[model samples]
Target: MEHRIRHLSTYSYDPAALRVALRLKLFPVDHEGQQVESWKVTVNDEEVSPLVFSDLGDREALWSSEDALDQLTITAEGIVSTRETNGIVRGMPGFAPPGIYIRETELTEPDEAIRALMGEATGDDTLSRLHALMGLIHERVKYLTGSTSARTTAADALKDGKGVCQDHAQLFIAAARTAEVPARYVTGYLQMEEETEELLETHAWAEAHVDGIGWVGFDPSHNLCPTERYVRLCSGLDAFGASPIRGNVLGETKESLEVSVAIGQSQQ
Candidate 1:
């Protein structure tokens, strides 16, 4: 499957004058099941600066404004071809050992509820158990937008019983780690066959390392493994680490952010 994607992020400053620095990981990963046809990143409507490669295999573009600016807009657009590999990530360069993913992050720290959820994943096979856990999470947490914020932790989302894809992925990672299965957070784009009022192009999912199969993606929010419709961007210990955009602002001024994303099947 092939997909065309467009993402626009705009930042507006209240004082209309502030210095800003940004790091972008908007580039898609080129791996065995995914191929990048064409991709580009632009800042303030111009081509991005030189890119620096990271150890996690993501290309980062750094941009800064020394002059007073009212707003900054970053746009990333590209076409990508993807294949369904049963959610298995293979033949990709490994950045960290599987055991490293078992370490807990602040957002994924497990509580009693998460520990109990991990215990409910009953199966002799690790793969099957993980699948069961995914189902459990889907049932436990209802998908409701605006029900949680970026600061929401796994335990908090579980207690609320409602959250978006990010919350689902975080809880899944926490539970998997509690079960001694190495898991990491993934950020990507999900192509929707038909646009809907509630549809979002950006998506989040969890990948757990199976003893025999390596890393496999599990989207508890959708209760399914990633398919060709998924375009993986990057992975990390948690959402904060895997965020597509990270930055800082100099000078004291209010900031407002707006993001728009579109992903659809490309015409041949």
Candidate 2:
């Protein structure tokens, strides 16, 4: 399916006397089952510097310079090609180290419960093992909106027995890692069953590295891999790694952010 995506992230400062820098991962790239037609990003404030390059993972680091700043806005729009390959990731150059995704971070870490949850070993079949893992996690954690925050870890979300899509994706990543599978977090857009004329903004999921399949996508939230209706942007170890948009500051101050997203289908 062909899709048109728009994402606008704006930040407002309480007092306009500080500097801001931004990192953007808002552009979509050609992936196993998806293609990017055209994408662009524009900044509202010239005070904020442009992005810089960094060799971290699949994503690029765009760093903004430190200068006097207040409010900042980053907007992105483009067309995306999406499909479902049943988690079959193909045509990737090389393999990412397992440790790069499993290391403990601010929002991702396998705790006692995660360890115990993943302790029940399964067979070696990649698809079957992933399916079993999905069942176990879905049964363990209930799906509820607004039950967890972006900072919530897999253990915490699992304990709460409910969380949003991000939490579900993170939990799946953590569980897959504990099971010795290399999984990464995905950020993208989802088309729900709403009758409204506007499309939703972004979505999250997990992709595991299978022996012969490379990377296979999985959405524990829906217990399925990404279909043609889903548009993928970027991925990382966790949300932090695949944040749609991020910023850094020289000094501390109060800030407010407002986001608006719209997705639509286009004539191919």
Candidate 3:
């Protein structure tokens, strides 16, 4: 599938002051199952060029300005072609190591419930157990739109029994890690449905490092692996680490935010 995407994020300041700096992770790179055809990032209608990839193999850059303004907008637009690789991520390098994801973060700390969940993933082998775990999570948590925030942790989300994609992904990571399986958080874009025209946000999923097969993707909330309809963005120990954009504004009394996203398939 060939997908065209546009994402616009705006930050507004109440006092409207001095400076703004943004750390960006909006660029997507070509990998085994994904290819970036054309992409660009812009600030306030002006194009930004020469974004550098981080040491961890992420396309990242920093944008800053000193001019006082009411709002700052960052826009990323691109065309990408993707294919289904049986949920196996390949040909991507420099991610520290597969074992590193075994470590936990604040957002993915496993509690009693997650440990119990992991214990319930009964199977003859690792892969079977992961699939069983994903099924368990899917049945455990009910999907609720806008039911979670950035600070919501896996334990909290699991206990609450409701959340968005992030919650499901985090909970899966937490549960998988409890069994000593190497797992990580993944951020990306998902074409919700063939008839769906646009979306207001990106998607989240989790990846577990299987011994012989490498990293395999899983989405507990949706109960499926990422496919041709999904566009990979970045990965981290948790959602915070994999966030597409993080920023700070100096000299602003207060701040507000608005985001818009659109995704569509190319006719040609």
Candidate 4:
């Protein structure tokens, strides 16, 4: 399948004065299952700098804020042709060996609740445990957008009973960690049907480590493994680590952001 994607981010500041700069990881990458047809990024202010190369996990860009500038706007547009695979990404470019991902992060630390959850399920199979965990999260939390923020914790989201896709993925990661399973966050895109709505923001999910197999993708949001309709970008401990974009700050006092994405399916 082929898809045309456009992602636009605009930042408006309450007070305008000096300069602005940012890092962007919005570019779709070329990999086994996907091909980048054409991609471009444009900043409204000509004074802004262009993107540079980085050896980080995913595509990145740097934007600098000089002086005391207030307003900032960023836009990204692209087209990509992608093919669906059999639910598995066989040869990921930089995947660490099987044992590495099991290392735990601060947020992913396991607790009693997680241990108990693990105990209830009597299977050593990582895939089975992963599916069970996904079901637990789906039942625990209701999907709602504004109830959670980027920093919401797994326990917090569970208690609040609401969060978006990111929260669901994070909660799942946290739970897996409690069970001594290594899980990471995945950032990517999803192609929707012609009548479907909501295609602007990037999508997120989780991956768990199996004893023999390396890292594998799971979308608790959809209760399935990633397929041809999904586009993979990067993976890390959580959203903060796998953020699509990051940047440095200058004298700018305050800023607001707007994001829009348009994804369309084309005849293969």
The candidate that achieves the highest TM-score relative to the unseen native structure: 3
Error of 4 at 249 (Å): 2.7
List the candidates' TM-scores in order: 0.95, 0.86, 0.96, 0.84
Which candidate do you rate higher for TM-score, 1 or 4?
1
Q: Cα RMSD for candidate 4?
A: 3.1
Estimate candidate 3's alpha-carbon lDDT, on a 0 to 1 scale.
0.87
Poorest 10 consecutive residues by lDDT, candidate 3: 48-57
Q: What's the ranking of the predictions by lDDT, best on top?
A: 1, 3, 2, 4
Off by over 4 Å in 3: none
Task: Score candidate 1 by lDDT.
Answer: 0.88
Ranking by TM-score: 3, 1, 2, 4
In model 1, where do residues sit more than 4 Å from their true spots?
196-201
Cα RMSD for candidate 3? 1.4
Q: Write the per-residue lDDT of candidate 2 for residues 111-180, one digit (tens) a residue.
A: 8887777666365686678777777776778888778777888889988889878888888888788777
Residue-wise lDDT of candidate 1 within 158-234, one digit each (tens)?
A: 99999999999999999999988999999998876556222354799999999989999999999999999888988
Question: What does candidate 3 score on TM?
Answer: 0.96
